[model samples]
Target: MTMLNQMKKSLGLLLLCTVLESHADVLIDVTATMVDPACNIRSENSSSPLAIDFNIINSSELNKSAVVKDFSLYISDCNFSKSLAMVLNPKGGSTLSYNGKNILATSIDGLGIDFTEVTGGTIRALEMNKKQRIYPERVNATLYRMDLQAQLVSAVPIKQLELGEFTSTVTLSVTYN
Candidate 1:
């Protein structure tokens, strides 16, 4: 080939190679989830599961508002100042009341357990899987106290409630942001 044609082809090939070398075929992106540290939770500073015994609940006492017991839970060992939320999840299935309230169903038929939170001297019913901000009795590095009340609720009339030993379970989950 002529000298000028050969020089032109070489220059074009070098330019193409330069362009191809400067371009990237694969790109890498780094990603991560930056999450705040989690806090510890316990039932009154004990590692065991919390249990409430409603001893000898009479069938006539089963109603929408018959309280079985009141209890407290504690959260501690938190290093973050961010807000914390909690969820009350029933282990088995929950019963829906006639008034459209969610109640934790017991082993007995038509009878379930309901929970309420006592905050600022006002009582509020707690719903299943609903996130609630933890208004700690005192926010600090130490223990935080949370009060809860359990009530015996029946889907049917009190007379229709099964008369025998009954038991129920609830799982509490905590999250912080």
Candidate 2:
């Protein structure tokens, strides 16, 4: 072949190889992190019923009441064999009284019932980051708030002692696209 034709052929082959390399698939990496809150439960008397107080904080950036349904809490101990505990449902009202103190029940009002059953609980995600999911679990008795009123009965003794610094971990599961 002529020198000019041979050079043209080599250039054409190089261009073809470059095009093939450029068509190779591109790769991307995705990652997520989950974190639970540090929770502690203490009982003054084993014989008397203990009332635990659970406070929910909207540390996220969301701002809607319906978001409450997106989260759940799971409570278990070192044994991990016993059935999960149950949390008391907040009375439908503007405020709830515990120990002669009036506390708001809804997040909109200010005070929030952040308490939930350690085994199965739910919290609304207000204006939180859309890519993140947080679930708070309870470590001790579900009845964190106690009403020391005339109707109050002797506190129920907490059994199956899982003593020590109990931590109610709030796991955060994130999904990104």
Candidate 3:
């Protein structure tokens, strides 16, 4: 081959090699999104069961026992005035007594479950256990821990507010490892 042609080919090959070498270090951008379930409350005035639905996404990885510590329920009404009274029954073969006198808290604010009256609806560390006791012979039952049914008693009758809506706001928080 001619000297000039050979020189030209060499320069082109060297340029190609330089381009390939420069492209070796790649810059990539990555991102992801995490979604969690929405939790809320439900209730009724008459002597009926209060059904609560917990929206749990990626529940497979959840340790039910560990997560229960962070679980809580705050039943309150409008005007932010009154909270439905509740009682705590420890695990033992106890008698079934629904005396109006066995009320835990007067207003939702009086209930020391959470910190504050409005926002203090949290179930504290001490309140949590490996399992919850709902009734007699039903020890270690799952009824009280995750899903619970409580009878509501108001100190004064639940008078109808002009708002015309009987509502209970429940908030659930979950902390996992």
Instruction: Write the number of the candidate with greater TM-score, choosing between 1 and 3.
Output: 1
Q: Encode model 3's per-residue lDDT on 39-99: one tens digit a residue.
A: 2223223223433322342323222222221222423221211112223432231222223
After superposing candidate 2 on the true structure, give the runs of residues whose Cα lies further than 4 Å from its correct spot.
24-29, 36-75, 78-94, 97-100, 103-177
Candidate numbers sorted by lDDT from highest down: 1, 2, 3
**Tens-digit lDDT string for candidate 1 (1-177):** 699999999999999999988955888899999865676778764847888888876666554346568888787766446687778888865655645867788887787777888845677778777887766677555878778888777778777766788777788877873
For model 2, give the RMSD to the true fold: 18.4
**What is the Å distance of residue 122 in model 2 from its true position?**
29
Give the Å error, residue 112, model 1. 1.3
Model 1 lDDT at residue 134: 65
Among all candidates shown, the one with the greatest lDDT: 1
Clashes of each: 0, 23, 2
Clashing pairs in 3: 83-108, 114-120
Score residue 140 of candidate 2 by CA lDDT.
61
Which portions of model 1 show Cα errors greater than 4 Å? 1-27, 45-47, 63-65
**Local distance difference test scores for all models:** 0.75, 0.32, 0.29
For each candidate in turn, the TM-score is 0.74, 0.27, 0.24
Q: Cα deviation of 59 in candidate 3 (Å)?
A: 42
